[model samples]
Target: MSYLKCSGMCQLIGGLLLLLLAGCSAGESKFLAGNLNAVNHTSAAINHFSVNGYGGGNVSPFGDGGGMCCVMLPRQWLPGLKLKVEWETDPNPNVRLPALGTDAYRAAYAKHKANYQQHSTIVDLPSYETESLCSLKVHFLSCNQIKLTTACMAYGQPGYPIKEPQVMKEPAVCPK
Candidate 1:
């Protein structure tokens, strides 16, 4: 009876170890090359988004030697998907007055109200501007709508207001 119990315990431990190793290997292989059906949203306002899978070339900013951040999209989804990027303009050193009735003007007025009552002085400053930097329009040739399983990076920077992937059956409509 004692020998049987010991053998059973060993078998249990060995099976668990095998399962753990298999899980790790499966996860690693999934990201190597496959269909990607998930989208990683890094922002609360839907400003930033990424997909799993590899890009054709080296395009990842954080990639070590190769392009690890490359994401592959199905040929069908490309028809309506688009990527738009905007960048903040360089800051101006000179201070300027805020436009009246604007949020900034109201804020500054509130802060300096007491000072102005005593010293009769007003101060205003300008804020940096953001402009559209680039836009990428993607188009795919295939008409079939199918899910793609793709690989994702092992580790990546998490964006604010992260969102889970939402699967849509119909094609995406672009915003005007």
Candidate 2:
């Protein structure tokens, strides 16, 4: 009957629309994201770093909140070797690292301070500049050994991207 055909067509169009909407929402989570590569020229070891930045101006006054940025460096290490880290973005233009350490904890702490000075503001979180975030150089023991480090900074909570979770309101229409 005409009624059955019309209903079937309407359901097909609705499904297609839902798929398109989901695709667009996928890109809405992060404003900027990518990897930074750090190399130890002396030992010929390489470390890959991943960085992420989130949050931008929202349309509603009560919409999501401030933004944050972070960097991750490789974990490879050596006893005598030091890292030559050129922080990607420095809040303070004057701060520079001429030397590196043996362990990762010390290196991370030291780099955090230098980066804070270059990119962060003393006043407010939302107003801080996101571009000054820097990449780090991870040291390694030997040519064959490699360690990958991952660090993430989020502008909002873990569930930010999926603002509204879908609810199953109706069951699928199945043949009896």
Please list the C-alpha lDDT of all candidates, in the order they appear. 0.29, 0.31
Q: How does model 1 fare in lDDT?
A: 0.29
Candidate 1 lDDT over residue span 15-127, tens digit each: 99999999987762221222212231211111122232123221111121222334432323323443322211111212254899899988865654433210011111111
- What are the per-model numbers of colliding residue pairs? 10, 10
Off by over 4 Å in 1: 1-7, 27-86, 91-176
In candidate 2 the C-alpha lDDT for residue 90 amounts to 25
Which residue window of length 10 is worst by lDDT in model 1? 117-126
lDDT of 2 at 65: 21
- Scored against the true structure, residue 39 in model 1 reaches a CA lDDT of 32
Give candidate 2 misplaced runs (Cα > 4 Å).
1-16, 19-27, 47-128, 131-176
For residues 75-159, write the lDDT of model 2, one tens digit per residue. 3322343222221222233434445674765776577555432111111112223433332212121222222222233223463
Count backbone overlaps in model 2. 10
